[model samples]
Target chain A: MTADLFLQILVSGLLIGLIYALVAVGLTLIFGVMDIVNFAHGEFLMLGMYASFWGFALFGIDPILSMPVTAALLFGVGVLVYQVIIRRIINAPMLSQIFATFGLMILFRGLAQFFWKPDHRLVTHTLVGGNVTLGSIQFGLPQLTAAVGAVGVTAGLWYFLHRTRLGTALEATAIDREAATLMGINGQSMFALAWGIGAACAGIGGALIATFFPIFPEVGSNFILIAFVVVVLGGFGSIVGAFWAGIIVGVIEVVGGFVVGPEYKTAIVLSLLLLVLLVRPKGLMGKA
Target chain B: MTTIHLPKTVGALALLGFALLLPLVIQDPARQNFLILILMGAQLGVAWNIIGGYAGQVSLGHAVFYGIGAYTSTMLSLKLGLSPWLGMLAGGVVASAFSVAMGWPCFRLKGHYFAMATIAVAEIVQVLVTNSETLEGAVGLSLPMGNTGVAAMVFSTSKLPYYYIILGLLVVTVLASWAIERSHIGYYFRAIKDEPEAARALGVSLTRYKLVAIAVSSFFTAMGGSFYAQKEMFIDPGSVLATGVSIKIALIAILGGVGTLLGPVLGAGILITIEEYSRVLFGSTGSGTDMIIYALMIILVAVYSPAGVMGLLHELRRRIPSLRAKAEVRA
Candidate 1:
């Protein structure tokens, strides 16, 4: 491939990686704090895509403008799911947790199919229009905008976790749930918060993906697999690791796409995942 | 699961005899189709349970093994003039090898994490098959219409032979499960599933148990796929290796009771019947009603009785001693 083509792929991949990081951060955090793999993380993004679509279609709102609303709404959704369904299964066997999330994923997908009929929906970006050239290489302005938003959100989240009191408590809970409880920190509430935030992250990722990829009932399935790949490559439960790993994965996808066919990109990505696990099962940024 | 007492087992055998004779008794094509499907589902479920239930290692990519069985067997028979009987064994062995290769790296993962990884592998296989020119690209493969005879192990008009074959396969699967339950291998599988570290500490070889579980699972699953391919007289990467097929196997296994011998069959039978009824009676189009039923059954089964049908019954039987006595009396 030509240098321009390679550069173009790199830029696109970097942007996509940011979104992958954003989506997977929530999953990582959920695993970190709650010790549960929130398998339904992708459906939250699905909801975000649909929400953004309606925002554009019904009220003529831009996805950028609808982002905060989606985040807030999805936050509430995460909390609700945690309290109503997840909390009850918190202490149950591992099998219960896996099936519950799977059930939730199926239920949401069914609801969408029943309501929307599997038709794909696209929401046109009003503000972020056209493309820009950087040193003779062109990139879409919307993807750049999404990248900026993703980076901004990641920075903001990092700050929230590192700088705030609630964030420290969350970190404490994730580090040692029993110790955190002994210290008068409510681990349950902290877990709920992490899941809520993770849900919100999914919403952001969904809105960004919807800006480009059309929304469908199976869209969630697509991202969920990628999200799992990202989380696994990053670590089982590390948000910072997921952020960086997402970028690595994104770049790998671009490079791998050039090496293999586009259809085989996912397979190549997974093999890379296997490669990483083979060398280091705990992942790159796993805690020592 | 029903108790394994000899007379009770013989009585169950008599019931199975009467049930298999339904095709001869009724002879309606629709009834024949339902019975065949039930047998197919049961067989698939039993196949799936070997890994999912027995080892407690949920693999989401079993369809890869299944497709391997189907394609290998069918291709061998068509190209090499081999009997499907021999070719099916070819498929089973290939799938077993594939499962071992895939499971080795994957089984390093714990529980649901392993499940997700397997799903990724399955997706990769689907994509690979879809793009392969050797597999006829996306055009798919068609078997030269084999005549309805025991020699070809296929049928053009009659579904009767296929029904009996699948019944035989189901019986074999159950007998295999029973044998596994009593073997030292079964004890190792149970120990590894419940407490891997403890099992390892107690001198169980983790690798051997896992490989055995997955190999057996793949073999049975492969047989089911080969059977399916012959029945359809057509096969493809998309149809055989799709996510839906893998999930269906998992669903039926989960529905019937994963670890139990007869549960997989019972679950598969019920699920296939519901799907067939939806297609015929309810006139639900391709995938719509089937997917809905699948999702609902999974949710209800997971929520109400996570152990599935056999587990649910076992608990009921445990609670009501008289119920067991009555069942014994009925037997």
Candidate 2:
């Protein structure tokens, strides 16, 4: 490939990578706080996309304008899921925890199929429909805007975790739940909070991409595995790790697909996961 | 203890005798097919119990072994004209070898990490299989229907032979599980599951035992896959290699009771019945009602009864005698 083409592919990869990071940040946060991997997390992203699509179709609200609504809706969903299903299995065996989440994944997909009829819906004629040209590089405006939105939400989350008292309390719970409880941080509420934020992050990601991607019941399956790769590669429960790892995974997927065949893209990323598991099980940022 | 065991043994034998003769009495091909499916599910579940239940390893990518077995037997028969029975044995051996190779790196991880890695491995295998032209790719391979007999492992006329073959396979699977459960290896497996650190401190090699568990589990699971290939006379990544198939195998074990010899059999009967009935009722509309019901059942069971149907039976058994004694005392 020429220099210009390479740069274009690299830019495209970076843009999608930000969204992957956002989705994984939620998954990693839930894992960090409660030590439970939410398999239904991608469904939250799917819901966000649907939320955006409905917003546009019903009220003529552009997907970009309705992004916050999607996030808020997903936050409520996250909290509801925790209260109804996850709470009962808080102290259950690991196998039970896995199946609970796995069942939830299927439940969400089934419900979505029931409601949405399994059709793929797209938010066409959106505000960010055109392309932008930089001195030597050009890309779709929707991609650029989605990347920007992802960066904004991720930065806000990072700041909240570091600068605020509640965020610090949440972090404390993640680090040591018993100690956090001794310190008067209600572990249950903290778990609920982590799930809310985690799910909101995925919702934001979905809304961001809704302008470009198709909305479907099973769409979450495509991103869920990739999000897992990012989570594992970033070190479980590390936001900063997920951020960088997401970009790396995205670039590798796109560029690897470019080099090999498109069908081998998933295989290439998964091979990276295996290599990481063999060499560094804790991941790039997981604690020892 | 012998008093308690004698009746149980007699009951088991009586049940087996009934099962042996049921195929002859049940003449409908469709009903026979359902029985075959239940047996198949039970076989896979028992196979998974060794590693997932006894050894305390949650491998979500077991379809890789199933797929490997199916592909192996199909390829051998298609290319070299080998009998599927021999191919089935070959499939089991190949799957066992592959399990050891895959387990080498994967066994180092724990809990969710290990599970995620297994999914990744299975996904990669599926993708590779789907893209490989020599393996027939996504088009899949169909076995020759010209020759059909006991030797070919194909019965075109009726489902009776297939039913008996699967019944024999399930018996063998349960016997293998019973043998393992009665041996010192079973004790070591439980130790590894309940107390990994203690097992390691006591000179039990966790990796070695875990590998043994996976090797045996994968062998039988692959046999089931090969049987599926012969029964269907077609093999594809979508049918045998899908993650859904792996989950179903694990679910059967979980729903019945993991670690117990007969739990999977009970689970298979219930699960396959629900699956068939639901499909029959809602399959045409594609409304996903079956999936919704299935998902709800899984969630409820996982939440309320993690120990499964066998656990519930044990609970009932313990409670019933106490209730009877109280009633007698009152009288």
Indicate the residue-level lDDT of A35 in model 1: 76
- Candidate 2, after superposition: displacement of residue A147 in Å? 1.2
Rate residue B135 of model 2 by lDDT.
97
Docking class of 2: medium
Among residues 3 or more apart in sequence or in different chains, the pairs in candidate 1 whose N, CA or C atoms overlap within 3 Å are none
Q: Per-prediction DockQ, in order?
A: 0.44, 0.80
Residue A228's lDDT within candidate 2 is 89
Model 1 residue A73 CA deviation (Å) reads 1.8
If scored against the real structure, what TM-score would every candidate get? 0.94, 0.98
The lDDT leader among the candidates is: 2
Residues B1-331 of candidate 1 have per-residue lDDT tens digits of 3456898679878968986887898688778877888888888888888888888898878889889988898889878878788888889999999999888877788776677777778888888888988777677878787455777788877778888888888888878877887788888889998888899999999887889989988998998899988888889987789877888888888888878878887798778877777677646653355556656676667666778888888988787998778899999
Best by TM-score: 2
Fnat, model by model in order, equals 0.31, 0.69
lDDT of 2: 0.91
In order, the TM-score of chain B in each prediction is: 0.92, 0.97
Clashing pairs in 2: none
